[model samples]
Target chain A: EAGVTQSPTHLIKTRGQQVTLRCSPISGHTSVYWYQQALGLGLQFLLWYDEGEERNRGNFPPRFSGRQFPNYSSELNVNALELEDSALYLCASSIRDRGPEQYFGPGTRLTVT
Target chain B: AQSVTQLDSHVSVSEGTPVLLRCNYSSSYSPSLFWYVQHPNKGLQLLLKYTSAATLVKGINGFEAEFKKSETSFHLTKPSAHMSDAAEYFCVVTGERTGRRALTFGSGTRLQVQP
Candidate 1:
């Protein structure tokens, strides 16, 4: 089976711009998670979506928001991006109610100038 | 709040040598622990996980981790190192008391294998 897939492997934007990153979970997976892997810092959870509902979120601000679709795909939107927002945004998916093992995607490298 | 700490930022070993990557986690309650490997420009892959079941968990690529509640650690180990094992390893903790399943990853330990 194909693993989780992400679109626009790399994204470039300037400060104050908005960016949207997309992720398609593996087949039969119902939970989608978003994480930001910045330089030096480790992977930080951003959002969690299941069954088209926002389940949980991290310590990030309101600017970091995301939504899941009926197909279990997800979209992470960043409003008024800052240079610090630049990082590798990863998307992971797992089978709901199964376990905590999540498969990840290649991730989108967002570069904000 | 819960957190994960990787004791070593980097570790170097010769091929066929044993490997050990230390990880310690802090949580008020029982937390689910996991080990993931990431290669350059690649996504994270699950090496193994412990969810209050067995103390020892085996995963892909000859990798395994032991969950020691007394030590509050879940350290990854391998009998023999391979060149392909050279990647960033992350120790993650989740399922905290708040019922949050989103993982809190460690700073990561980069493994270097010498051929």
Candidate 2:
């Protein structure tokens, strides 16, 4: 059983650029969540996708959006990235509506210069 | 506005010594609590969770936490510390709003296990 996996491991972009981060969940998981772990800001929930539907989102900007694929994989897109947008973005997944226990993937570290 | 707070920013303990990581939460409803661990460059791992069933919750790697409602705290503890246990630990609380369980995380506590 492979755990959640993320892509690009790291990314470097300048201000006003757009960055996309990807995540593939465990085989049987149906819910995927995105979280932004900015420096000194702790972890903030970005979005939640369940069964390909945009379920919930956090207090981030509209430029920060994401979606889920048919196979339960997810992609997070941060547009007009600013220096403050630099952070380790994490993706997690779990069985649908199964409460708060989520399996996480090694996050994608994005550095906006 | 629900929030989670880790009482200690860092803790140091020797091998085989007991370890404690304090957490406090504020919520209007009967809160759902969790503990997560993260090593450098890695994602957060679910240490344990309390879903109102049992006050004392045990997680992997011999870690446990007790939810005290009166004090509004859910503190993580371990009987013995191991070098492998050194990492950043986060205290989290889940908000039950509109049938969604959104987690509120605290500023992590860095645990150091001395050999």
Whole-model lDDT values for every prediction: 0.93, 0.91
Error of 1 at A106 (Å): 0.9
Residue pairs with backbone overlap in model 2: none
Compared with the true structure, what per-residue lDDT tens digits does model 1 show for residues A44-86? 9999999999999889999999899999999999999999999
lDDT by residue (B1-115, candidate 2, tens digit) is 7998899999999999999999999998778899999997889999999998989999999999999998999999999999999999999888766546567899999999999
Q: Please give each candidate's TM-score.
A: 0.97, 0.96
Error of 2 at A98 (Å): 2.3
Docking quality level of the chain pair in candidate 2: medium
Each model's iRMS: 1.3, 1.3
The total of clashing pairs for model 1 equals 0
DockQ for all models, in order?
A: 0.79, 0.74
Tens digits of per-residue lDDT, candidate 1, B42-79, equal: 88999999999999999999999999999999999999
For model 1, the DockQ equals 0.79
User: In model 1, where do residues sit more than 4 Å from their true spots?
Assistant: B96-99
TM-score result, candidate 1: 0.97
Model 1 RMSD in Å is 1.1
